[model samples]
Every structure is written in C-alpha cells, then in structure tokens.
Target: MDARRDAAEDGRETIGISWSSPTRPARRDRRQRPCAVDPVMEIEIVHLDRRHAGLRIADPARLAHLVGSLARHGQQSPVLLVKVEDRTVLVDGYLRVTALTDLGRDLVDAVVLDHVDEVGALLLRHRLQARRSTALEDGWLLIELLEVHHRTQADLATVLQKSTSWVSRRLALARALPALVQEAVRVGSMPPHAAMKFLVPLARANAADCEAVVVALGHQRVTTREIERLYLAWRRGDPEQRARIISNPRLFLKVEAELEVPPVAPDETSALVDDLEGVAGLCRRARKRLRTGVLERASASERAPVAAAWRETREALRTLAARMDAEEFDGRPRDTHRDPAAGQRRPQPSPDREDVEGVTEHRQEDPRGANTRGPTLRSGIEAPAPSDADP
Candidate 1:
C-alpha cells in the first residue's frame, strides 16, 4: 500500500502496538493523538533534529548493509519523528537517516507521532524495527535521563515496567565505564557487549590499562571470544606481560591461536601410547599422594567433587581391566602371570629372590588392630601387565 493513501475507507488505526503493561495511563497522560486514519509522510533531511542521535551505538557493518539495501530497494520503512518547539526531532531510525544521507538523498519517508516527547518515544521504542537494546545502551539512556535530564529512578522504573534494582545496576555499569571506552563503543570500533562483560571490571581495576587496551583494538576486527581470552590472560599475567598485551593485543591473540594447533603425530599408535603413559603417570602420582592421607585433612564440602571424580575413574579402570582379560583383546593364548585381581603383580622368578626360610617369629600389631604383613611394607603403584594396545 502507498504511504500517502487515505486510510478512512479502509478503517486503519494507529501504529497498532502496545508494551509490557497493557493498562496504560488515562488518555490524558499519553500523547496518543486521535488517529484520523493515518498516512505516512515524507520529510526533508535538513529538518531532522538529532539531539538523541548518540544514544545508540552505531554498528559499521549494519549501517553499510542498510546503505546498500536502501539503494537497491528504496526505503521500505519510515523514520519516526517527534515534534519539539519549531524543530522536528528524530526519535528513531538514526541509521536510516544516515544511510539516506550517504546515498545523497535529501528526502526521507517518516511518521510523525503527535504530541509525543523524546522521553516518551524512547521509553516506548516507538518504531517499526523491533531491535532489542543492549544492556550498555540501556545504561547510556538511564544515565542521561537521571543525571542530565533530571528524571528519577522510581519514575523511570514505572515507565519502563522494571524494578528499581534493575535501574540501579544499569546506572552502576554506566558509571564504571571509562570515557574512551564509551567512544569506542559508540563508533563501532569496539563491541558493546565485550565492553560490558570484560572492560567494565577492567576499568574499575585499572582505568589506564583498560584505556590502553581499547585504543589497541580501535581498528581491529577482533571478536568477543578473543577479547575474553585477552582479558583472562591479562588478569593472570605479570606487569611486563600485561604491558606487552596492552601494546599489541591482536598479536597476542594470534600467538595464542598458533600455540593451540598441535603437531602432527607420527602414527596413531604413537599417539595412543603417549596418552596411556600420561594416564599411568597421573595415576601413580595420585596413589603416592593418597598414601600421605591428603583427603584426611580436608573438609567434606571441599572433598565431595574429588570423591565423585575418583569413583568415576575407578569404574572406568574396572571396565578397562575386564576388556583387557577378554580373549578378543589378548588373542588366543593368555599370559600366565598377569593377575592384578588381588591388587598385586606376579614378578618372574629370578636368582636374586630373597630366601625366607627361617625369619618367622612373633608379629607386631598396629593401633588399628590389624596384623602387619611383614617387617617392611612396600608403598608404590603396582605396575600392571601392559595392555594389547602396546603393539
């Protein structure tokens, strides 16, 4: 349908949208003008008042796509306008106005909401594009309304259909952000979410370092994951490492990526043997530690997760033992001396074996009331017979 068409014959109403709370204020409280049906109108680009233009952080890629789309398909949506004094203020569609200007067009299709103010329009998000605002964007708006525009938190909470706690958190986030980081976010040089998650805490910790990092990332196309990795490393790094990261974060990310790419193994057998040996080494170390009663000194809460992990590992070892003894794995002839069912290995007979012909006498007893096995007790892992995977 044409934007300029008469809506009386069709019985069309207003924008036809509502928000979180369906029960709105009395019509006197709202700027809801009577819809004499409705007609979308065209406004000149020069007449737009962009006072709230910087409220949204413009994304470069999104703006470029919008420019291309406007060129190929003309304007499919209208920019929203609110009247202020003698000037017509743009309440929404900053990107559209920008895109049209980039295309060298002077006129833009727009809708004028009668008697609506900037605050009302922002609260309603009065536009066709249902784009959700990020938390950082919310912080910007909340700060402006409270400190500069003189709006109270309670009043905003009522209008936004949110609690006062939510408003306070947004204000805190905005307060902690450094000025330079804010500029980076506004111009699309830095991702808003990355700033919110990683940079905010960083600024609180060391504002100078955060500023340096933001400057380092100004023109780079680094992702949120990469930023997170950088932030984590910076937290764990020493002063010198942190300085190097601040100087060239992109290079650090590249180096980290290279380190994760493993060297090609000679063969699958070699890789398998390496993994088995690693597991065996860990188990032997664990047994040595357990003999020292490491678990005996810890509280139950601290030991719960460790106990659960140990139970899972023990069950896996049992399954491995059963599979090792199966004929399909060991092949036809079974080895005669591989019994670990009694938690002991059978060593081959040698001439160096000690003679035990005449040493027996009265045995000693420990405090736990169990008889000692011998004068000396061995304390080490029993090396199991190698599995068939050794080949």
Candidate 2:
C-alpha cells in the first residue's frame, strides 16, 4: 500500500484514551482499532507525552496565541508523532505541543504514525508551516531539514509540495550571503534577496564601513540605480569615488556649487592670460630672492667665499681655472697652495689668522709660538683678514 494511504488508515483508529492525566493509558486499546481491513492514511487523537521533538517551530506569535487558547479551553487538535525504537517521536505540531506544555496541560492529544525518518518529518513540517516564515528563517529550516536527509532541490520540492523553482531560488539567495548579512536578514532590517546583492559591495568594506553603507541605503530610500552606481564605483577601485562616497555631503555641496556659480564669458580670455602671467611673474621673483639669499649666506661664511657666489665674473673664471688645474695634475702631488694666476706653488701661512702684503717668502713659526718675522698686512684691505673676521 502507498505510505500516505497506510498512514491515513492507521490514523482513523481511535486510540481510546482520555488525555486528562499521564497514567490514563499504557498502550493503544485494540478495540478502538480501525474496523476496516484496509485503513486509509488519516490522523486521529491519542494520549502521548509531547516533549523531545528537537525541532524549533518559529511561529512564536501563533504559538503564544494558541497557548492562550489552550490555557482556557484545553487542546482540541492532535499532534502527529511517529514511532521510533519503542519510543514515540513528534513529527508535526511541535508548536502545538509547546503551547500545550506552556499552558500547564498534563497530557495532550496526538496521532501515532509509522516511523518516517528525520528528513521526511522535517520537510513535511517545514512545508506545512514554515512556508509562512520569513525567507531567511525558511532558508535556515530548509538547511536544517536537509542536513540529515541529503535531499536534492527537486526532492525537496516534491516532498514539501512546492515548486522546484521556488526551492532553488530561495536556497540560492540564502546560501549566497555571508553569516553577518544573514543575521541582518533574519532580523528583518534587510530583504533577504536584496540583501544578497548588497553583500557584493559590503564584502569589500570593513565592519564599520559596511554598517555606514547599510544605514545610508536603509535610511536614504536610495533607489536601485543609486545603489548600483555606488557599487560599480566601489568595484572600479577609484580613490576619488571612494572618498566621495565616504563624504556624501560633499557631493551635495558640489551640486549646489555648480547650480549657484555663474559661467565665465568666452570673450574674457585676456583676463585669464593676464592672471597666468601674474602667477608666472611672482614665481620668477621668488626664485630670484631665493638665489640672492643663498649668495649672501655663502659670502658671509668664515672660509673664502665660494667662487660661484663672488660678485665679479673674473673671480668665478679664476676659480674654474684653478679647479681644472687640480683635476689635470700630472705626476705631481696635488698642491693646495698652487695659484691659478701664477701657475706655481705658493708659500704656506701660519696656523694663526694673519695677513702678509706682497710677501712671496714665508718663515715657519717656532714651537714656542713666535716667528722671527712678525705678521704684516696682505695685498687687500687691512680692515681684517678673511679668517680673522670670524669673531
């Protein structure tokens, strides 16, 4: 016989026990069995313990209302359970059982069923009830129901009395999301399928950044086009676009500025050129000032002024000639005292700051710090020697 027909036949039998208390019945009374030899699959009321189902029925509001009704009038409907290893297991109406338990009922009505495996029961329960649940919740139920059963989408649709397309679409949406976004969908702030699309951009963002984006999309009533625009920009990885999104107020400001500003006259080209020339002139003056400052600093140094910084061009030429002579020296030790003008080695001076005027000869200072010839003025001004100008 077909399983449904058999279950229906078994369901017609009267278990013949009052659900007033736990010790009311031990086993189903044989007399209340279906009189017909071929029983049809249908559910009937019986006495049974309504715990240990392990499946969560997510309709809390319905359950609470049902509990309140049961509290006043007592259970009128029978929960369905299947026999497993000499123990009865709940197959359907877990919420009803929960409502009855919450109402403090000692015993409740149920139907004894042939053992349908965990998968079949889960699929039946979800199909019968959880279809009314939110997409995210339904997705979780489907996953939980399938984990032990390992049913394909077509099998799920067949057993659950739903279309294969519906099952596939919902499963795809649920599985596409990361855990955190799934939580958001469960909490009902985001639409489950729409939230999947949002994840594409949000995965690139950090937690806080994602929160900001979610808030913006949630609060701004942002259109699909606006969201797509932002998402595409994010994917392009443009720094300027990212900054614009980060500071959205600036985008408004830019638009406002454009609206308020006046257009420039096409014939006023001379003014733009004049402005460019003014900027160029200012840059030129700044360069000149910087060069002059450097020259003054070099000239004031205690050592001889750098040749390049000298005011007279002749001094620069002489400095270049002296550098060339040093670089082109052949087979001779480099003489620091060589004069470029005279082309010969010059006399060395004492370590002390002194000047000697037109003196081609020199006397070395004694260790006692005295020289037989005293210091004399050099060829130039006698105001102070270049080295003596230090202090």
Candidate 3:
C-alpha cells in the first residue's frame, strides 16, 4: 500500500458513510478530558482523517496479513477515532483502515471517543494497544506525543503512569536509534522487532557502528537470527572484527559458516539418550529461572510486557508439543512458511552415517517427508533474552 496515498484523499472512495458533515472544524490544542466511547458504527472511509499515519512504521507484511484477514473474516475489530474540532481523526488501527481501503471498503467499524482531544486519544491508544506494540512503534509514538503534541516527558510519564526514567528510556529508543535504521524500519526494508531487540543497543553503544551496519545491509531482507548473530558478535568482537562486520557482513557470515569440519557422529542409541537428558536438563533449568525470575520484583505495568512474552512462549511450546504428537501419529511433514533453502537440492543421505564434504548441516524441512541425513545440524533457535526488554 502506498502510505502517501492514505493522507491524500479521505473523500476519494464513498462507501457507506453514516455521517456526512462537510463542515470540518479547525483543529486546535485543547485540554484533554475523560474518554467517552461511542458504540461501534460504520463511518465513511473518505471522511476519516489519517494525518498521523506517516508517524507509524509501514510494515507491508503486517498490512498484507491484515488485508487477508479482513478479506476472509471481514473487519471484526473497530478502528479507534477521536473528534478533532468535529473532524473524525484516526487515533489507531491505521493498518486496519489501510486494509479496508485495499479491499475497496467504503465504511469502517469505528470506536469514536468523545470528550478527548488528539493528545488524549493517542495516549488512550498507547494504553489500549501496548501489548501488540513493538519498541520501534512505541518510540515513534512517544516521539509523536513529545514533539508533535508538545508534551513534556514528566507530564507524559504521569499520564502514562510510568516513572520518568521509563519514559526517558522509551524516548531514548528513538533518540538513540540511527535515523538511517529508523527509515529502514519505517519502509519495511528492516524489521522493527529485530531493530528493537538487537540494533538499538548496538546503535547506542556506537552510533557510527549502527549507521555503518545499516548502510552495509542496504535493502536486503535480513532475518532476526542473522541480526541477532551480528549483534552478539559485534558486542564481543574487537575493533577490527566489528569493522569487518559493519563493512562486510556477508564475509563475516561466510567465516561464520563453520569451516569444513565434520562433527563426530555419536552412537545412535547413546545419541538418543543424550538428547533426552538434554531436554530434561533444559526443562529443569527453565523452571528454575521462572521460579527466580524478576516477575516477583516488577510492578504491574512493568510486568505486563514480560507476562505477555511468557504467554507467547507458553503458546509456542504448546504448539511444538502438538506438532510432536502429530508426528508421532502420522509422521507427516509440515509446511514451511519461510524457508531459506526453498530451492536447494535434496541433501543425499550419508552412507554409514559419515559426513559429506560441501554439504552444510542445516535443520530444514522437507515437505516430501524424506529423511535428510547429514553429519551435523546446527540449532537455529532465537537466543532467549535474559529478561524481557520493555517495549
């Protein structure tokens, strides 16, 4: 979707406009009042104001997914809105509104909040959608509030019910992340979550390094795993190593590719035993961490992101267990949504369980249910965060 077009024609497509007051009252900075939500109603797409749409990071993947959902199930959720001098201004659900536009939708399910100005609506949106928000999104949103709305950090902290330090950290996310990286995220050239997790701190450690890395990456579709690898290596590596990473990440990846050393194969029966022991050890360790983790020490709002992350982790483990059960019953293969080796040649089975030269060890899926044999398979799990980073 062309983001620029969103701001262009509010009246371009006329579909099911319930209210058609041509009088657009002038916008003003007014005092915020209590939220007054109207029942969900259909509003004309052309009448909706999306002047603040540019403030959001434009993610094509997210928009595509939303478009598909809206197409399949219709707009089950409502877009948030506020009355600005009688003009209905969008406060949240830009993606949903965009999806409706893509689907040639005339009207949108809207929750118009009364008695609140633009500033109050934005704060309400932040509180309402904090769970689904990424650090990049939150940073930019906070920046919008601080600079565009002329809000002080202390005032924002008080309204958001957070400490001033927490507000600064969130502001620092935008202040600290390189503008180059921020643009990359905004245009979908880079991922917002990966930037939040790996690149922000990398940028703060050395802004030039962040700039160099962003320039080196260009517009390539990099993964969370690759970015994570680069960040960890850069964190620990020396000056020469870090420079090489910034200037020539591909070469770093090439060197990172395990040299043609064949991992010694363990006895099959013993390997099974070792794998079971490893799984048990991991479970025990995870349980111990959960028992002693910072959840008990954190406040309610502070613990929200962490608790949400845990729910995701729990759901993922549940899915894995279900997949395992399915495999036990049917031994069928699962579809790959994103595969690096989509067009790669089938790896030949190693005779006598011996390693083959030039054949890299990757734990990839085969839709054909073929047993792929290799000397070793490297784990590709994302590195677990020691603690959840506040979004």
Query: Top model by lDDT, which number?
Result: 1
Candidate 1: lDDT of 315?
A: 61
TM-score of each: 0.59, 0.35, 0.52
Better of 1 and 2 by TM-score: 1
Full ranking by lDDT:
1, 3, 2
Which ranges in model 1 have alpha carbons more than 4 Å from their true place? 1-39, 126-129, 261-391
Computed on alpha carbons, the lDDT of every model, listed in order, comes to 0.67, 0.48, 0.66
Give per-residue lDDT, candidate 3, residue 252.
Answer: 80
* lDDT pick, better of 2 and 3: 3
lDDT of 1 by residue, 277-342 (tens): 787788788767756766666577767777677658656655554445432343566433333343
Task: Write out the backbone clash pairs for model 1.
Answer: none
Candidate 3 wrong stretches, greater than 4 Å: 1-47, 54-62, 85-87, 232-244, 258-391
Error of 3 at 112 (Å): 3.5
Residue-level error in angstroms, candidate 3, position 69: 2.9
Span of ten consecutive residues with least summed lDDT in model 3: 8-17
How many clashes (backbone N, Cα, C below 3 Å) per candidate? 0, 9, 1
